[model samples]
Target: MPSASTRPVAIKIDDATRDRVKRLAEARHRTPHWLMRQAIEEYVDREEKREAFRQDTLKAWNEYQETGLHGTADEVEAWLASWGTDDESPAPEWHK
Candidate 1:
């Protein structure tokens, strides 16, 4: 048997929105409840991604503040050149 924790809640929607959801659900062969759940999940996932990016940026900024990149253009160029990335091949990919 299913748990009561998964029980649906009743809510009111405008006619226009309800019609749109019905059409979309019909097209996708899914219930309106499922579509709404998927939409909420996607929204939460995108928000999480944005929050993670913001946190990473703040952390990097703090690190840069501690160890300033106070080098001349020539020095920066020399360091980059020392990494053996000449005009031959493309740079490495950094996919997660």
Candidate 2:
């Protein structure tokens, strides 16, 4: 029985997908419902991160257009390469 925090969800899938999910669930020693829940959780997590990244990129683009200040690819690469090293430094200066 579902607990108070849980609600039942019904999803329709093609036969092939249903079979695949069953097989995967068996292999992982989990019920189909658990597998589906895990898949949905992972997918939502990944997509949310992707959406956040897209939003950040759009904001950066708008800022660049408004200020005409940006970093060159080479400078950006150098800064990225410095990550996790003793020489790690702040972002390169923005240029027109």
Candidate 3:
């Protein structure tokens, strides 16, 4: 992340929450600004990952719809169950 060309954004908070944030910041020995910035960054990171997963799910669904090809739930479960052992099974093949 670049510190240059950064802008500050202001948000309104309730007095109670503001006080709580202030106390928490004091206890953590960090400024409120740093705390909020860290929180926003973490939230954005988590939301981005969630969005990517959603996109992958949609793509998978669309492909399945178009080709009418997919593995059965039982097959997927069996494949997943074989995760790390002496005789791990191969992945279930997709079929129409």
Candidate 4:
């Protein structure tokens, strides 16, 4: 019996796409269901990360607009370049 937490969900795909999935699944020794599940899971994970990044960017933009305080592009680039180096420096100070 399937686990209580697991339930079936149906999705319709064109015949061509369904055939392609079956072929790929056969080659990879996986079920069509597994392939679709993996695709959805990875897609969700990627989209979630993208959404988070977008939100963070918007927040940073709003904060900059409100405070008018920010580090110079060159300062930020230099700090980024120093990453993983022995002399990694602290982040630049924000200034008005």
Q: Which stretches of candidate 2 lie over 4 Å from their true place?
A: 1-4
| All candidates in order of TM-score, best leading | 4, 3, 2, 1
**How good is model 3 by TM-score?**
0.89
Model 3 ranges off by over 4 Å: 1-4
Model 2, span 38-86: residue lDDT tens: 8998898899999999999999999998999989999999999999999
Q: Write the per-residue lDDT of candidate 3 for residues 20-82, one digit (tens) a residue.
A: 989999999999998888888889989999999999999999999999999999999998898
Worst 10 residues of 3 by lDDT: 1-10
| TM-score, every prediction | 0.59, 0.87, 0.89, 0.91
Give the CA lDDT, 0 to 100, for residue 72 in model 2: 91
Q: Which regions of candidate 1 are displaced past 4 Å?
A: 1-12, 70-96
- Each model's C-alpha lDDT? 0.75, 0.92, 0.92, 0.94
Lowest summed lDDT across 10 adjacent residues in model 2 is found at: 1-10
Off by over 4 Å in 4: 1-4
